[model samples]
Structures are given as structure tokens and as C-alpha cells.
Target: MLAGHAASGQAPGTGPGAAPPTTVAAIQQLDRVEVAGRHYDNAVGSTDAASQGTIRAELLKSRPALRPGEVLEFVPGVIVTQHSGDGKANQYFLRGFNLDHGTDFATFVNGLPVNLPTHGHGQGYSDLNFLIPELVDRIEYRKGPYFAQTGDFSAAGSADILYRTTLDEPLAALTLGQRKYQRLVGAGSSELGQGLKLLGAVELLHNDGPWTVPEQLRKANAVLTLSDGSRAEGWSTSLMAYDATWTSTDQIPQRAIEAGFDRFGSLDPTDGGNTRRSSLSGEWHRRTDTGATKVAAYAIDYRLRLFSNFTYALERPATGDQFSQQDERTVFGLGASHAVDHTLGGLPARSEVGLQLRHDRIRVGLFDTQARQTIGTTRDDKVRQTLLGVYGQTAVELAPWLRGIVGLRADQARFKVNSLADSANSGASSDHLLSPKLSLILGPWDKTEWFVNAGRGFHSNDARGTTATVDPKTGDPVDKVAGLVAARGMELGMRTEWFTGLQSSLALWKLDVDSELVYVGDAGATEANRPSTRRGVEWNNRYVPRPWLLVDADLAWTRARFADASPAGNRIPNAVDRVASVAVTARELGPWSACIQWRYLGSGALIEDNSVRSSSSLTTNLRLGRRLTPKAELTLDVFNLFDRRVNDIEYFYESQLPGEAAPVADKHVHPAEPRTIRLMLQLGF
Candidate 1:
């Protein structure tokens, strides 16, 4: 759930129960309709900042995504890549931050939060494997902490994905690709009478990746929803279930690959994971002339069993350094908000207030393992974590050309952890924080607008870390960490549609964190680090030169460093400095459509010191589609269109080989999938 107008202003999809209108061209009752896209979606006056906008479903469908998480790449400056198996959470990078497993970023589907707190693998572990892209209607996104509606894990940014309540037609699709990749999906919506509609979707997939050990991945996912009315006056309930299992090929040391090992080979073939998630959620919305109200509630059941071998034999030469992480949890959440439109001193104004609550009952553990068998327990804990946030904001038209938005948020967190193995490490604690936000919007002159936004935000540390007193592996005293860390950010931006058939924006932003403390879930401890600062500039553009052609380009550059003095150099590890993307799409070209895109990931420091740096990578993807009949279509997708040799992720760390006398420091890399092809036939009934 999001904050009120006072906290974040009148952002898209933030007004009381109101969703942003389609930004692209509207549908026509002709033989064919031109699909909507960001290029056509105008945001000049509707958005509070240049960095915030809606990505339409048409744009999502036009792109070729190798994984579910890659969908987030649609957000400018964000990169999504996998370091391990398909079943695991994808690594994310944004705004000069290596948002490991969803840290400092918030994501929501419909109204259910996707980022899990106190997770076994990592804090705020967000797994989007259950997402069905075709079912998404639109995605509303915002960056920084200038919004009250978003509370935690949002210091960098947040995205809220909305699902369509109904479909234009029923769909059935089958896809087959290289490396034994196969998939089947079916989705449809039906009228249930009396303003009630039912939507259902299901997906089944299998793939054996291009690894020597074979990444035997399998998945089953489904979603069902019942809804009545529209966003301004409606209610909906949904049920979702997803399950996945896969054998993974983790990153291999450069020395091993140079020593005659296959680049795609795995040092530990047994490394893999299994995960399942099921949830029930409901939402209600009502709107009138002067006021509106909305409420959302959800319950979720989730479980995960993951085995990884990152350090090889560095610690346990006898049996290798393999380990297992197990997590099982039940989560409950509720949110409610109300907004009123009024007049202030003869000026038009709007105010809103909201409350959000979430609780997680979790059982999590870390263990030493051989193959997939647990040999020893590092730590086992039962955690109960609760979060409560209340926020309010107001938007006012101070003058003919000036508008202002201000808000405040209060958050309270309670962490209760019971260390099953070490009572000395268990404790209960609570913390609270207050955040304030402000935004100023000036002008719509010449189809352009200027914006200034500033805010304070916070992210919660792991509950275990907030209460731990001793390290589980080493019998040493440990210092507890703050339950909450604060962050401050500001942005100066501009959005314009001054050029015909084009929408472009530019933003200059800066963010500072009080501390870079983090919980090391793999070892069940906290890593206290230094304060940091990040600054960046982003430029995004979209153009439709013709009714059937769309072109888009976006570029971002960031400078990140530790704020405190350190001999290890001030550079932040894995803080990407540059990113760029270009895309061209042609649709309705006489029953044929095509799209091509190029993405670039610039080099960055691999460690605190800048001596070791990663290499930049560029990749291209292409999609071609044709209509077979009024009800049938065919499509072909090529990933890594140029067959580029590149790595998906890279890290510098210490590890030991089976016969090595001692440990060695080297670069570990997971190679990106080579050129691959997929073909699909879709039928509408």
C-alpha cells in the first residue's frame, strides 16, 4: 500500500482508489487496434517527478524476457540478473546500489507485498517466479523516499504491478526453445453475472539450461481472481499458487575455467533449490465526488529449501563448503486509506491518510551441508516480526503555476527472535522512526513541467541481527544492529512532451544512507559497515515517429562511495556506474510486427578497492511476430541475438579447489546464456 497525497503528492495511481489512465493511444473499434506503449503514454502533468511513470502491458509483451524478474528492467536504470538458479530470487541493481535479493527496493503485485522480511536467504528476499507477465495490466513505479505510502525496502525505489480484472479474449499458448526449453500457458476471464467477473491463468514450464551439469528447472504457477466494478468503485479477491525446483550452476572461479574446466561447468552440480508460495488477497475501493476509501488484506504461506556452495573448500576442505538455508513462514497484512478533496483559502486542495500493518511468523535456519544433506546446524531461529506504518499527505495549488505536496510517516517495528540453538543469542526488541516528504511542481508551459522532491526513508534490518548477541559459527561476542536505518534523498527533474510524438525526461538525484549495515543470512550474523552516498543522472526518452513505429532510449550514470574515510578505498563494491538501453518496435505492419532491443551494463568496482573492476557487457534481443488468422498468431524470439560471450554476474572472492593446498582469491563468474531461439503459437478463443 502507498501513502497519502500529503506524503508523496498526487503520483500516478496514488489518488484515492484511482488508477492512472492508459498513457498510450486509446482503442478504436476497427478491425485491428494499435497497442499502447510508454511512447504514447503522456506523463507531463500527471506525474509528480520525471522518474515516475507507468509501463503499459503492451510494452511488456513487446519485449523478450528470459526470466520473470527481468520484467523489472522496464524501469529505467534498473538491471535484473540471476547469479544462481531460476527458482531463486534474482539479483537487482539500481541507482548505484547492488540491491542484493531485493534489498532497498520494494515490489508489490496487486496489493500483496512480494519482498519477504527475515528471509532465510536474505533480508527482503523478493522472488517473482510466480508472476505471469501476460496477466499484468500496468506497472506504476516511483523512486526515492518522497512518498509516504511506501514504508520499507524503498529507499531506492518501488514498483506496484496491477493485474487485469478481465481479458479481451481467452488465450492458449505453447512455446518451445533451445536446450529443451518448453512452456505452456492458458488464461481467460469470464462474466459471473451481477457485476462479478472471474479471471484465471495457469503456467507450466521446463528447461535444461546450457550447463554441463544441466540446470533441470521445473515450474508450475497459477492465479485466480474475482472482481466487481472498477478501481474507483469495486472489490476483488485473488488466489495465487506457485512452485519451482531447479538444479543450479553457480558462478565458477576464473582459475578453474582457465585450468581446462568448461566455462559453463559447475563445481558443485548438487547446488540448487526448491520453493513454493501460496496466497489469498482481497481489496475494496470506493470513490465519490469529494472523498474516497480503499482497503486491502492478504494472507500468505511460503517455504524454501536452498543449497549453495559459494566458498567451495575454503572452510571445510574435507567435505567442501556447501550449506543449506531453510525458511518457512506465514504472513498477514492489512492496509486502509481515505482521501478527501477540499478547498484551502480559495485554493483547490486534497488530503489523505493511510495505515498499513504486516506480521510474519517465521522459522528459518542455516546449516552446513554435504551435497544436499545437512551435516551441521549453524543457527536455527523462530522469528515473529511486525511492522506498522501510518502516513498522511496533502496536495495544494498555492498559485496558478505552483503546486506543493507535503507528508509525514510514522513506522514501528517489533522483532522477537528465539534462537533454538543458542539462548544467549535470542532477544526481543522494538524500534520506531518518522519520515517526512515534500514535493514542488511548477509549470506545464510548453508541454513541460519541473519538479523538486525531497524525503527521508528507512529500511529495516533483519530481526535476528537486531537481537543477536553471539555469532553462531564462532563462539564470539557480537554487537547488535539498529532495527531501522535511515536514508535521505532529493531529486531535481523535468518531464516534457514538447516535441511532437515524443516523451522524454531528465533527473538529477542524490541519496545518502546513515549506515550500510546488513545481515549476512548465509552465516546468520550482521555485518556492520560504513555510511555511504550516491548521486546520479538519468535520461529517458520514448518516441513514436509513426503510428506503427516506437523508439525508446534510456541512459543512467551514477557515482557511489563510502561517506567515511577508509583505507580500503571509498568505492562501493558492485555499485554500477553506467547503464543504457535502446529499443525499436514496429507493429501492425500489415499483419506483421517486430521488436529489437540493445542493453548495456557498464563496468563497476568488484570490491571496496577499485583495483579489481568488472567488464562491461552488451546484449541484443529480437522478437518477430505474425498473425496467422483473426484468432491465431505466431511468434519467434531470439535471446542474445548476436551470440555474445559475456557473464551474467561477476564477483571477486576467496575459494579453494579440491586439490589446492590453500585458498586463492579470484574472480567468479556466471556466464550469460548464449544465443537461443524460441517459437510459439498462440490462439485466442
Candidate 2:
């Protein structure tokens, strides 16, 4: 092509008429290179900031963790917690924040939001533990609100999980290794063909991992998928199942508390929980010259259980007694989404029209096991909300090298809270939101592509993690607490490929969110009407210099601050100041591969209050693998290789407190894991 380089720089694959390597001359003849992912096996190669894949021949050749969460590590603004590597309670953080551990990311499996309608405080109780490693053929992340039909994603983002179809022939694999630092998993798939597919995988993960806590993790996962031909056809149906059971432990250090990294130093590893999820969905579509018409329906169920004793007995200055106690929460949800749409993209213009409806309900209860009474006397509550929306988007090819996309949507929700024990406290309210988006991509150079995007999106009220307590007198909690309403954000980004197989993406974003609920420090609880701002940047890069080796890196930095005065005075907890990672992968021998990953994390804010925070930290992971065949592989991995001293509590002396702040600063940092390693072997037939 242009010179001595490959035309499109795409890795080798088995497909019809693939593009030449990514050199100037080759690209001129072949417009774009296709990569493997959920939507299309032959879509253009992505230099996008939040897009990546493991299905690429090169990436798949090396044996690695089979879960989508593990692969997403290469993306910016994303950090995953294996719950001590157990896999069942797997967790993640985005935009320097966690959505109540698993609740916020709004994970999806095949265009379906994995969140359950009944999850407590919107905490994620979806089915991340459902799929066996083999069931997920590939995974994808659609960051921000760039696409149509998808709006109301607060600060973090959304993820799309794609299941691998069963092949015509039978396949089998076994990944036997340590969980946490060492564990094992086995998987297989079969194709009945003629409009049928099946995939399945199961794993046993154990980790006596990298934290100071007496770490131990165990969980099992399985996923099954049955789908008709592509949606382009007339009709299709899909079935899915997800499940996982796990328990984890944490031990925080007392000194790290003084450093401002956490609220408490340690958590008894004996504290543990179990979780599960299941779902089903179907779609029907008809294609035409002008646009494609489609209708779809989906439903999901999820559950979670937690049992732990709060052991950090920090003496409250006024009470002289720590609020130490045993706690448990049981939550469930039911929901369905129905939408009809006209898709427009193949012509000189792009457009989509659709309407969506969703209903969600959550029930929550907590009891102080030690005291033999519910923590607040009236601990049971029920909240239900319904969302209806009409959305549309269009893209026009302005010129040869430029294109633009414009989109708009309107949404409304009505929420009602009911509790038999506190009927008088029940209340009902309605809210509406409008969203608009604009995006433009420019191609000045064949290999250099740039994009600028701006959008305004909002949503009605919802609470996360923190819930209201009883009034102590009427057995009723505050009704209008923190109504999540009308949040807005803007996203700007760019992506490009450079010399020597390097690809990079940069994004800058800002968010302003307002909630009707407010927090009160004096009462050690919250009420209603609060606002905050989330602003940050995400930087990511990938380098595949040779056919058998690659390197990936990502950095996420944010400054999420209170936009209005709160009982804590413009302060919020759990938002980290910074996070970064670097990973290197190697495949020098046929059937052999190795990898190493490094992480750097700045201090994190406190969990329920802003007075304390987590500490700065750094850790590393190393792995080795050998491929026995195309469908089989083996590997060994070590987590927290250094056994670096980790601290979960960060305390500030009254000396460091800003004027008029709490004098004794004590924050809790959750310990990660201790150094550990695992060996694994997997096979496919």
C-alpha cells in the first residue's frame, strides 16, 4: 500500500475479503477494516476512546480471564473488583466512583439493561455472575450517551455484553488454576444450526488474595443462550440465565486511617454475602428500503443478601459508643422494556424513531441482629417508578470527509413509596426530562480520525446505597428524601491510530446532578434536596507492535464536588481523586503467552460522609498461559504480586481538617486482597 506497512493494521481473521494492512495506500483502496464484536463481525476498526475487543484473533489467542469485566480493564474510567476474586460479587467503578459497588454501571446483556427493578437503592443485583466464561463470545462497552434510545446515564456509562453463539460442532474447554491469585473454570458450546445455538461455562474461583483481610473467595457461574437467526430476519427469540454465590472478607489497617484514605482500618473477613440474577428477552424486526421497523420486549429478575458485623468500633465523639452492629439486607425487583423503532442508517441520511416504557420496584429492610430489633424500628420500604419515553436521532453526510448526528428524546416518570407500617408516610410525584445530542466526526488524514460530541441528558429521582431511616416517633422515614431528578452532562472525545501499531483515545466530560434528597450530619442520616457535580477526563491507549504481543494503558481522573451546601458542607464520599493502570502482554512462542498489569490509585473519599477518605495505593498482577488448541488453553496468574502493605482506613488529625470541620478525622478504606496465584486449563471441542 502506501509504503511498507499493512493497509488497515487489522489483525488476521477468518472472514470474506478482509482489508489489507493499515498503510496509506491500502486504506485508499479499502475504506475501513472490520473487527469482531457484538454488532458486526466486520465493522470498521475502532480507534474510539471507549471501544475495544477480545475477539480479535491476536487477543483471543492468548488465554486470559473469560469474563467481560476482566476484559474491560483496558478501557478508561473503568475499574473492577473481583470481590477478592470470587467472581460472584464482582464489582466496578466508573468516573472515579462506584454505583453502590455493582449498582451504577447499568450493565447489559444483548441490549438489555442488566439492572433489576427491585434492587435496593439501585444497587446492582443484575446477573454478572450468570455467564460461564465460554457463553460470552465477546464483550463491548458503549460509553456515555452517544447513541440514540440510550439516555439518562448519569456520570459513569453503560456496557453491552454479547454472548458467543454455539458453533456447528461441539466444543469444550477447562481453565484450571487458582482463583483470586489462583482458581479454575471449564466451558463448552454446541450448534444445532438451522436457527439454533447454545453456549455454556462454569468456574470455581478461589482467592486467598492481595489484601490484609483473611481473604477467601468461592463462586460458580453459568450462562445459556438460544437465539434465532439475525434480527434482520422476521422474528427472533432469546433466552438467558445468570447465577453466582460468593463470600468475601476485608481487614483495614489502623495507620492508613491517619493518611486520609479511608473511614475505618479493617473489616472482619467473616462478613460475607450471596447474590443471583436471571432474565429473558425477544425481538421482531422488518427491513425496508427507507428504514427498518422493529419491536422488542424484555424482562429480568435479580436478588442479593448481605450478612456482616460492623467491627470498626470508632467511638462517636458524642455517643462515646461505636455504632457497631450486625446488618443484613434482602432485595428483589421486576421490570420489562418494550420499544418500537424505525432504524435509518444505510442511506445518505441516518435516523431512528422509538418509544420505550419501563417499570421498576424495589423493597428494602435492615435489622440490627445484635440488638434484636430493626435498626430504625421501621426498616421496610417499597418504592416504584415508571418511565416512558419517545426518542429520535438522525445523521447526515454533510460532505465527503464529514458527518453529523443530531438526536432528541423526552422522558417522564412517576414514583410512589408505600409501607404498611408507615402508610401515612407514602407519597407520589411525577417528573419529566428532555434530552438533546449533537456529534461530528472529521477525517482529515486516512489514519487520523477526530470527533467532537455534545449532549444534554437528564433523569428523574432514584436513590443509591443510602436509604432513609424511621422518624423514631411515627415509625416513618422522610418521604421526599433525595429525589433524583434532571441530571445533565456533556461528552467530548477523539480517537486516532499512529506509527508502530499504536491507538489512543481522549475524552473530557462534565456532569451536574441534583437530587431532592439531602444528607444531615447532626442526625447521622439524610433527608431531601441535594445537588452535586461530576467532572473528569479519561485517557486510554493500546499498542500492538508485533503479531504476538501487545500493551494497554488507561488513566481516569475526576473531581466530583458538591454543587450545593449540604450537612457535610459541599462534600461527598466514595469518589476517588485519581486511578491509573498499565498492562503488557506477550506471546513469543506458539501456544504460549504471558502478561503483567500495574495499577496506581489516589485517595478516595469516605463512604457515607466526606470527613474521611481512602488512601493512595499501587499494585501489580502477573500471568502466564499456554494454548493447547484453538478451543483449549491453560494459564497461571498471580495477583498483588508484591504483597504491598494495604490500608483501608485513612485518618486525618484535627490538624489537617479545614476550618470548622470535624476534629477527629477517621475514614474507612476497604482492604483489597493479599498476594495470591492460580493455575488454570481450558478446552473446547
Span of 10 residues, lowest total lDDT, candidate 2: 9-18
lDDT of 1 by residue, 1-685 (tens): 1212221222222222442211111111111112223422335555677788778888898888999888899888888888898899999989998899998999988667899888899988999989999898777788899887889999999988778889999999999999999999999999989999999999999999899988889999999999899756998889999999999999999999888999999889899999999999888777766677777788999999999998899999999989999999999988888777777787677777888899999999999999999899998999999999998887777765677788899999999999999999899999999999998888767767788999999899999998898989897999998888999999999987777777889999999999999888878889889999999999998887888888889999999999999889999988989988899999889889999999999999998889999888999999999999999999999999999999889999888988999889999998999999999999999
> Using lDDT as the measure, which candidate wins?
1
- lDDT (Cα) of model 2: 0.49
Candidate 2 structure quality by residue, lDDT tens digits, 523-578: 22344536777888888766666756667678878887778755655645667778
Runs in model 1 lying further than 4 Å from the true structure: 1-42
Best by TM-score: 1
